[model samples]
Target chain A: MEALLEVRELSLRFGGITALSQIGLAVAEGETLAVIGPNGSGKTSLFNCITSIYRPTSGAISFRGEPLTRHSPDEVTRLGIARTFQNLRLFHNMSVLDNLMVGRHLHFRKNLLAAVLRLRGEETRHRRRCEEIVEFLNLEPVRKTRAGDCPYGVQKRVELGRALATEPRLLLLDEPVSGLTQEEKEEFAYWIHEIRGRFGITILLVEHDLRVASRLAGRMVALDHGVKIAEGTPAAVQRHPDVIKAYLGE
Target chain B: MDLVESYAEDLRFARRPAARVLLGLLLAALAVFPWVAAEHLVFLATLIALYSIGVIGQNLLIGYTGQISFGQAGFLAIGAFAFGHLRIWGAPFALALLGAGALAAVAGVFVGFPSLRLKGPYLSIATLGFGVAVYQVFVNWEVLSGGRSGLAIASLQPMFGLSGTRWTYYVYVLLLTGFTLAAYNIVSSFIGRAFVAIRDSDIAAEVNGVSLTRYKLLAFAISSFYTGVHGALYAQILGHIEPQIFNVLESITLFVAVIIGGVASIEGSILGAVFVTLVPKVFANFREMVPVVYGVTILLVLIFEPLGLFGRWLKTRLYFQLWPFR
Candidate 1:
């Protein structure tokens, strides 16, 4: 498969602490890639670097063929990349549907004059799109409910729905199912699998739950001490000595 | 029995018949108020309308966008003086009003730049400094504001057979209605969503494709524009423009109105305006006690109704809507 996202020699440092050192990876088109690591292994750091939330100490990140390091976070999203937070970051006071609508901000006309005139055809079109996502995510029941008032599992789904609303070419989910119950986990995994087939978009996820990660990801990269310890098929990466050592300790 | 069955229904200005009727009744009352009420009452109503426009603007920045500004009086001063100068140059009334707003909006953009890096109390102090600087300029610059002695304004010329306080009342009421509608449109649109998102979580907002710099600045410009127009109307009402009129105390009064009314609420803006405008009139005999009353009212509201007056209104309305269930 052709690569959709490429990272090379990405390094991030804070004073004496190196969060990620010379980390490199590639996500191919229409494939789900999982980055598995222990706490503080820099899984989130890699996601942040690609999303332009953190400027890498050194290295290059490209989406399709365009360089991404110099762009701001909003600019990166405009380049057809969208992401979810490990801890849900839904606009708490806004309704669930509004949260999804915010994802379509870049696509809106953004003309102040049009807004004042109440020219709402474009708003309706976008609302329709969000409604569809709300239906797909089984959020129809709480569509009008404030996001902060929703249950945690529901908020998580709202976060996913929001990312999907952006119509992104590449979706990055950071621990999408970390706090979910086992039943919710299975449901989320099913959605993750369906996202790949239904949306036909590349996904890069950082997951601490190895079982769910391996189940959703066809290929896996393992990280230890901010280093890429192993990369291969899920079963092979699971069995690799380095991966085992990283998880179970030396 | 009101149900929003479609997106369009949800976005309607008055979704239910009851609301539409209430709005019609309110407009009818306002239309007849100047004729039926005493002149002093009409004057007070006009003041409320003018301050309402400014309060709404302040709410947009502090409530919706979560940017604190104690320098709003500075923008108001700019608008007042801008109008005064424009009128001196023989500009038409409408042109002078708009020019004042535009000029103040420019100043708002400058003040907003500091907000890009500052937050909370630090941002408030920076804005406070801006307000003080504007006051000093108006005080020292004789050519502009006529210095401390002040610039006298001529009474507005009547049009369409209206005159004096009635004419001024109509103009302010009409503009107030227009500005309120525009603010409503802005708060409901994607731009408004971006503002609220920044307030809630700037990090998530940026990642969701909202440029923090752009939206933050837009909030300041729009907010200041409202205050600027208010300043022009205020100058007309007072019949004088002086540096002391737009001082730090004036800024604090506007800020107080936003807090006492409600944060992030449209109704709160109007309610807060009424409270700020009428409270002093109620205590006119005990003029020195006005600040004490304001302090007490704020404390009471903060303690009992943290969401402010609008939140209390919502609860009351909800209770009535759900009557017999409790």
Candidate 2:
């Protein structure tokens, strides 16, 4: 498989406290890679660096062979990467459709003048694109609802829809199954396969549920204290004594 | 993934129906003001509408994008003085209006650059300083702005050879109505949703592919451009221009109007504009008790209706609908 992303000895620090310490990773095109760790184990921190939310203190990140530098989060997104926030940061006041439509901001080609006039078939095209995205997410039923009033599971689904709207080559999921129940996790695990199977998009997930990650991901990378301790197929990594010790509290 | 999908659904549920009807009625009333209003009332209405344009500008920056701006009046002053000076040089009214808007947009960019590095009260104070500096320029530059004494603007030429105060009043009213409608459409459009997204969470907006620098600056420039057009309109309607017309207090007044009406609500601005403009007249009726009346009303609005009249009305209506049947 062709390499879609690469991170070499990436390190991130906030003042004197090191959050991500010389961690290295690479993800192949259309592949699913799971990063599993306990709370404060640099899972989200690694995501922040990959998404350019927290600029790495030392190390290199490349997407599709292009070096990633001090670019804004949106810039990183424009380069075919999109991510969902762990805390759920949906635009609460806007309509359901509008939230997804905002994900397509990069697709807009017209200026304020053209937008105001609704000129040259712009409105029609814009409307068509919005409808396509809404349908893709199965959001037609509540396309006009406000984002703030939804249940936890559905809100998480909206975040995925938003990420998918970016037309990303690589989608980052930060604890997608963290707050869900076992049944909900099972449903989410099913959608994980669907996202990859239907969209042919690469996914790099950071999850805490070992069983879910092992089931959903073809391979897994384990981290403890901001360092990768093990990485391989789920069964191989599970039998590795370190992985067992971390999981079983040995 | 689930979080994102559910938020999308919630957003669909947020649009209210009664608000749209109220907005439509307000726009219709404003559109037909000149026919029934007295000359002085027409004059006052023109002023109110022009100021509403400034408030709308503030709303774009602070209400939509969550950036506090105290320099919108400075942009308004720039527009007023620029258009007035251009008119003196024999520029057509429309050209003068566009020129003022363009200049204000450039100024907006300058002000907004520093803002990308600042937030909260720091941003407010920086903009406040801009407003004060602009006022000083108008005070000192007698050649262009007529200094402290100010400059006189010629009466607005009537459309299609029509001439009269009534005709001009109608013209101003219609123009303002058009602008209000445009502003309404903008706030409801996709880009407008981006602004709200930026306001709610800049990081989230960026992750969703909204370029922060571009969108925020666009908000400032567009907001300032509208204020510039408003300034030109005010100059034409009043036939006078002065620094005092766009002072720091003017900035406060615009903000108060936005907050009292509803921060991000277009209809709220119109209601707030009318209230701010007419409330003084309410005090006028009480003669010596004018200040007292003004104070009491302001206090009551602040204490009893924190979201202003609009919030109170929404709450009351909701109460009636949900109350355990009569």
Best-performing candidate as measured by DockQ: 1
Best by lDDT: 1
TM-score against truth, every candidate: 0.98, 0.89
lDDT of 2 at A218: 87
| TM-score for candidate 1 | 0.98
| Per-residue lDDT of candidate 2, residues B228-285 (tens digit) | 7777777777788888888887677677777777677666776677776776676676
Off by over 4 Å in 1: B3-5
DockQ of each model vs. true complex: 0.82, 0.39
**Residue B75 accuracy (lDDT) in model 1:** 96
lDDT of 1: 0.92
Q: Write the per-residue lDDT of candidate 2 for residues A1-250, one digit (tens) a residue.
A: 6689999999888898888888988999988999987678888999999888888999999999998867889999999999988889898877777787788777777477655543424444555666776676567877778888777877787887888878899999988888998887887888888889988999999887878888888889988778888899988877888867776788
Interface RMSD for each of the candidates? 0.8, 4.6
True contacts kept of each: 0.74, 0.64
> What lDDT score goes with residue B37 in model 1?
97
